[model samples]
Target: MPITRWIRGAKLSFARLPIRGGAPSEPAYIYRDPWKGDAEQGARIVSGRFLFERQEYSFPSGRWDQGTWPEPAQEWLHSFCWLRDLRALGSDEARLTARALVSHWLSYPPTDLLVKNASVTGARLAAWIANHEFALASADRRIQQKFMERLLQEGRTIAAFLPLPAQGWKGLKALKGLLAVALAIPEQTGFMSRFLRYLPAEIERLILADGMVAERSPEAQFQAARELTEMSIMFRTAHSSVPPILETSLDKVCPVLRAMRHGDGALAVFNGSRELYSSVIDEVLAQGARQKLLAPSMSQGLFTRLALGKALLIMDNGPPAAEGFDKRAHAGTLSFEFSYQRHRLFVNCGSAEVGAWNKALRASPAHTVLVADGLSSSDFNAEGRVVRRPAHVMCEHQTDGTAHWLETSHDGYYPPLGLKWTRNLYLGGEGEDLRGQEIVEGERATPFALRFHIHPDVTVIRDDEDIILKVGGMVWRFRQKGGQINLENDIYVARGRVEKTQQIVVESIQYKISSEDNKLQESDEASSKDSLSENKEKKKFSQTVTWLLERIPE
Candidate 1:
């Protein structure tokens, strides 16, 4: 490792050493937890178990520190959510449970490395600071002092080991924790200026200009926005002027975040995103920071959106998240999700919490895209690391008259299958008619399959060469040419559970061109037009698939 990295590691390691001596001061300011809590969930925690992400796990009562917990549960433990949830109950039982758990963990601090995660540490520090008033409200002086000592130790450790460059979400979260510490106690006041200086730079680095997280997860984007909002409140409460960058970041982010939503108000599950409940989106936008400007057709985000009339289509036109950020990136390049008014029509299989299902859900076949050779466009290893990815991708959007056109192509298949895929989408002026053209170019014959995952609410009816999708009062006809269509069973992972769903698959059709047309040609516009005519003897084979979706009148 480089000296700089080694030094950072050493500093972090040194900071984790138990500090028995320290005093915890009551926070001068407390920022509200933007995410609402559930008292029922808090009841479960008091029972010595955690029900997180719809997955439940139990630990022996009062022996919580003796065993390793399942994920989400483990992460939840480190997140200090018991304290946050305790506020929801505001009951004696909840307070006792919270005190017991905090005392247990503080007494027998887990050796698990996840406890030291930058984001978790930051989040826990902030959570403790925000709920200190309640957690330290105990009449017992010993209990209060122990809680304060733990908070001071955690805050000091987090300050010493704040995430470095390339930390992505983890670094931003660490900054939030440091800022919390700075706002809470008088001794850590210096962190305020440093946090203010780093806040803008971190936002600019992690949040793209189009207001998407660099990781490209809609869920992650929302988390960043929420933290930034809380930070803004913290600064205001501390009588420190909010930074212009903080406000400006929210301005750019809120609208794009809004655009990513479906009519149902849930976020699109593109890259490792899960559908979160509550009117959180409304709460974020209600601050008046959101601009009501029309959504852009293409963003720096992995998804490209085109809203025409009552129809909204979000297409994945960008590559997977970069290497370090690929933990949550899905191999669904060129996949898409579509919604009309209040109903979702076409959708990608939302992300899962964990296990084999989660890995399978991230594959290309689980999305609305063409899967070549039964493999994902971007391959992944057993550990969810991206083993392969597209080398180049090109996407463009144009408007002609009242019609909107979006064209995108990727070379993800070129490396293994020697095939290139391009898709063109045209939305009619009234958004009643949607047309698409898919072209595959390759040197040799290769089996290809086009998949279109549908939302569970949409029912499909076969009509010979056409497929009709009915959702309540609306109807959409899916027609295709030159490929066989089949409806296959699928799964939709969303809102914390998987539901049985269906997908439309179009099998590949082979086509061949004469040797005269086989040679690679220049990309000049003039040559491209005449190239077809130049190969007169070329017995043209259908190398394209055309499909259309037209709204049927009531």
Candidate 2:
């Protein structure tokens, strides 16, 4: 390690050395838990059975040892620290189990890095602080004293090693832990004031001017909003005024959150966000200040949204997220998701529950866009990082007071094949008609495939020249003019399970480019005139796929 990093590490180690001033006073739980508590999971844990991530284990001897637990189980143990499940059971037996679990955890702190992760530690602190009442319902004063001692120790450790709040989602979470510590032990005068000094500025720096989170993820935005909401409530309960900047951040974010939701209230599965439980989203939104829904398009978010009658469309017109925030970013630039009222009609095959399924879901083919030469537009590795992203992504929106549309293009395949994918979308005022065209241009013959995934609940049937979509007591038709369409088997990963699904694929379309086309491409003004005059001849060489989606009465 470098000398500076080594010195920093040494300082961090010393800083976590359990600052004890004899058991800090515990404040009452002020923030309400937004997530649903699982009583069944609590019952299982109390009975010496543990289940997590769809897997189960039993420990009837009722003992858990540090260093022996599997890496996967550490996260599960953190969830147990929340005490939501135990609180839900509301029984003396469950209360005893909770106390014993906390005692065991304090006795043997895990050395694993996962246990010390900023996000995990923040969650542990919040859970422990919020559930103090349930955990300390014991008659033994010694047990209560030990819990407070350990809680204080954990708080100090977290504050000492907390990452800078500019570190994206993890940083936000670390701040959340520090805030919980301050709120839970207001008598810690120095610590509470120190937390207030940095909290407001950190919140402002991470929240973008347009209200989107710095990571450009809907999921992270939701988590940030929820944290701010809790903090606001805590401040109010403690008779302290909520920070104006914090309140402003929450107000600005709620509309963006509302704009990102589908008609069914589920967030768009864009960037790296998955389709988490919709109810949790509802709870978060309920806490924010009410605001108008987002308009048709957001420049800061770099996405176009069109709400026409019952149809809602959200298209990614932005580039891949920048470096530090791109870990969970997907390679599906220019991809989109569509819905009719409460039912999703078109979507990208989203991220799955397991890491093993990441490569397939993150590939360009899984999105509702054209993949050229079978290469992903944005290159991603197995770990979901953007190894290489397109250098440029351009988007333009135009409307004629009735028809709304946006045109977008990306240069992801420019280096390898000198090809670009351009898509134009048009939606009718009534949203009864949706139209699009894909144009592929380059110097060589490039093979491209276009995919359109349907929601698992919807069924598709092929007619003579089009595909029929049946869902939500309505019918719609999918027709193509320049590409062959087929029904292919697919998988939908959401709601904690992977289910068999289907996708409509347009394939085997090749476009050939020549030296003349390349030279003409260099002069934009001259090429525009020439291409219009030679439109028919250009079609012979260029690949153009035009399609239409129209509502059909049942």
Candidate 3:
């Protein structure tokens, strides 16, 4: 049942093979004019203009016909605007267009289908191949034979698409799928063995000892996980055993997948990806659950049904895994996604719609921790370049059965003045309820601004002794008494900006300090200058401040 149901009696059709014969010729069905201003128009545009246009296609690396970039491939593989709008015209037109699109896709052969933008090509190709394989089940033998022939050819190409010396972990994922397909084909075992030899080296580089993917985007991790899972399935279905290298790959995939789920069935939209592949994860988790493969309490979430469970800790710790591919990795460093009891408690403010990184929706304030005046730790313009580094200064995480703690620091505002900033969170308790604390430390007693970005739909209020957040008919409250902070709710903040506030409370040993160090630094530096007038002008410059939050136990 994990497979999608197919429509019956849908005979697969194709135009006669183009030949140098003396026979009457007709316009191929793929070239038929589409209805103007109708859904079919889009298909016509794609097929006749985009897909078939000679000028738009280029054989990159002598293998695949690709657009100048990834846009075209993304359009062909995922766009539904054409099919959905065309379906409104009538089932016949919709079906015809759909069939044509499918046929067009199958006809191209894998060598000419993948785009040159290697960053997402592997994942995209894997998805296309997986879906196409399903579609082929209903295809006629002729179509199947043709498809299989192309697959075999592509399988050989994939076998030869060895990892590049400079591509780093990027090629590992694509190669993994390429190897899977190659191994599944009966005659390609020789190529498969050679490909398998390189996997352990790649695994050592891409996967951390703790099972996190090195680049740290939850979306990337999910994509990698899906590919790994699919490869595993492909080999298993063929009654073939996984290569030894896969053991390390699976070790990374399993735990990270568990950590990336939110309390809801959906995943935390991190990095450039937004669409939730819940069904895919569900299927994988189901397999794990059946085999009793999941660690107890490690991946507890509503989406963790006996099958197809969700991830528990989603972290966009850094940019895309592959160095040059992800243009949308955010400036927020060491940012993370967490869900407990199905409630999402922490998040980065998602990226805005305007700008170059617009397609990278994960960079917004709604999905990160860099708040007011605290610029991202890394430069956005330097993305995918050799100079890129995490925007965060430092980050660390530790977990023990019932307790977990995470800490992060950054100097996003340090260049203007000399200062550093740090933030920490600690969560502990047993069973139904949990207690937690946050502390912000810095080099200067600057007023730090922390803005906790929450879903606009949620209600937030400060009670006499506690901070309360309510969402979807559920409530959680954090009480501050005797310098202690206690809470039980899905408290999630995409961004928290804190600055100098007049409010201060003292209890036990915890102290609250908020000051504008940026202004103070400017003032001091100005005082040291001989030009008082110039110093005054400089002092007028705004100052950057840091905030500190300490939790006290009752």
Candidate 4:
């Protein structure tokens, strides 16, 4: 390890040592958690067990061991985040159970990598401090002192070891904890200065100027926006002006977040993002400093938003993020999500929370995009970084009285397969007709598949070569020309759970081109022509898929 890292780690280790002298007193400030917790969940925690999807897992004798806890509840247990749920109950029983949990953990803190995680520790600090007003108001002064000591220790650990253990937007979580510690103990001038010194730079680095998160996930953007909002509260507690960078970062993030939402008001699932709670999303946005200046444009943030009448479309229009930031990046270049009014008519299979599904959901087929040779546009290596990504992604948008049009292409497949994929989308004046063309062009015809995942609520009915979709009283017809069509079972991970869903897939029809046509040159403009050639051969029927969706009257 580098000398700097070694020194930092040494300092962190010392910070974790039990104090030999008098314990610290309660922190000066009472940090608010900002987001509400579920009282029902809090009741479950107080019951000494967790209820998940109607299943119960009683806490084991060894509650502090990572392996002892149910896999689904490990992070929540370790970070003590459920304290918020307990506090939400705001009853004597809830308080006693919470105190017991904290008291037990203080005597036997988690002794595993999960508890050692930077983000986990950051969250632990934030949670422990946020609810200190109630969770630590015990008559037992020893418990109160221990709580303050733990907060200071965790905050010091974050300040010393950040950017080393913290990656992508996870760093924002750590920064929030550090700032919380800073505000809680403004008497510690050095600790406060440390946060102020590093905050602006970290904010600028993790969040792009256009407001997209460095991780390139709209879901991560929500996390950043929410954490910053909470930290804005922390800054205010300092009795000082809120940092300008914090407000500006919110300005940049909130708008992209708004544009990334569908008609249901939930975030678009892109780059390993799930549809976070729309209510929490609304609350966070409301807390943000209103943009005094014009907010950043969605296009500048590598997203294109189309809105007219009741139709809303959000498309990912950029290449994967840079190295360190691309760990959770998905092969979703040119993919999109579409909704009409409050119903999601077309959607991407969102990122899963755990297991192999997390990695599988990051592949191109998970998104509403064309996958060449059944492979992702971007490729992830073992470490989760996007090892190969689109080198060039070009996007153009045009809006006229007749339609809102978008054309986009990416070269992510070029490195492995020597191909490029272009997508064209048009939503009509009345927002009823949505037409799209998916084309794969390269040195020669390439076999590809276009997968369109539907929202679980949308009922899909097969009609030979055509498909009909129904959402509540709204109905739409889906038709395709060229290639074979099939329906496949799938899953949509959203709102913190998975639901059974189906997808419409169009597979290319392979055919050997004449020698003269085998080497047809590839150009974005050529693939995006206003009209396809009348001649089947000239149109490259084997490499194109055209589909349309028009609202059908009830």
| RMSD in order of candidates | 4.8, 5.0, 12.6, 5.6
On the 0 to 100 scale, the lDDT of residue 220 in model 1 is 76
Q: Flag regions of model 1 displaced more than 4 Å.
A: 17-21, 60-72, 163-165, 288-298, 514-542
Model 4 clashing residue pairs (backbone): none
Q: Highest TM-score among the candidates is held by which one?
A: 1
Give the TM-scores of the predictions, in the order they appear: 0.90, 0.88, 0.59, 0.89
Error (Å) of candidate 2 at residue 279 is 3.3
- Ranking by TM-score, best first? 1, 4, 2, 3
Q: lDDT of each model, Cα atoms only?
A: 0.75, 0.73, 0.43, 0.77
Per-residue lDDT tens digits for candidate 3, residues 1-554, read 22211211111011122223322121011111111224444444434433321124322232134435354444344322244334434455445554455556556533332433232334433443444422334556655555445444444444444443334345665565455445445454664675677666666666666555555545556655655655566666556786655655776466656655566645555654442546656666554322324323222111111111222444443433445444445555445544445555444444422334343334334343533244344445533432344444555667675655555565554544334545455545432233333343443333333434444344556666666556555565544332432222322222221111111222223333334545555566647456555544333222222222222232
Indicate whether candidate 2 or candidate 4 has the larger TM-score.
Answer: 4
Model 2 Cα lDDT, one tens digit per residue, 78-174: 5455388888887899888887877776666656565456666767777776676677654376666666666666666666654353455556556
Better of 1 and 4 by lDDT: 4
For model 1, residues 1-554, the per-residue Cα lDDT tens digits are: 59877877787677666656556534566666655677887888877677765677774444334555656567667778567777797798887777676666666765667656767777877887776666655537776676666666666666555444565566777788888877776575666766776777777778886777788777877777777777777787778888788888887777777878887888887887766663877776665354665346336775787778888788888888887777778898988888888788888888875667778888888888988879889988776668899989888888775788989999998888688899999998577788889888775667888888888899988888788999969988998887888888988887677788888888876676634454532223246566745544333323677888889975
Give the higher-TM-score candidate: 1 or 2: 1
Candidate 4 Cα errors over 4 Å, as ranges: 51-60, 63-65, 68-73, 114-116, 163-166, 291-296, 512-542
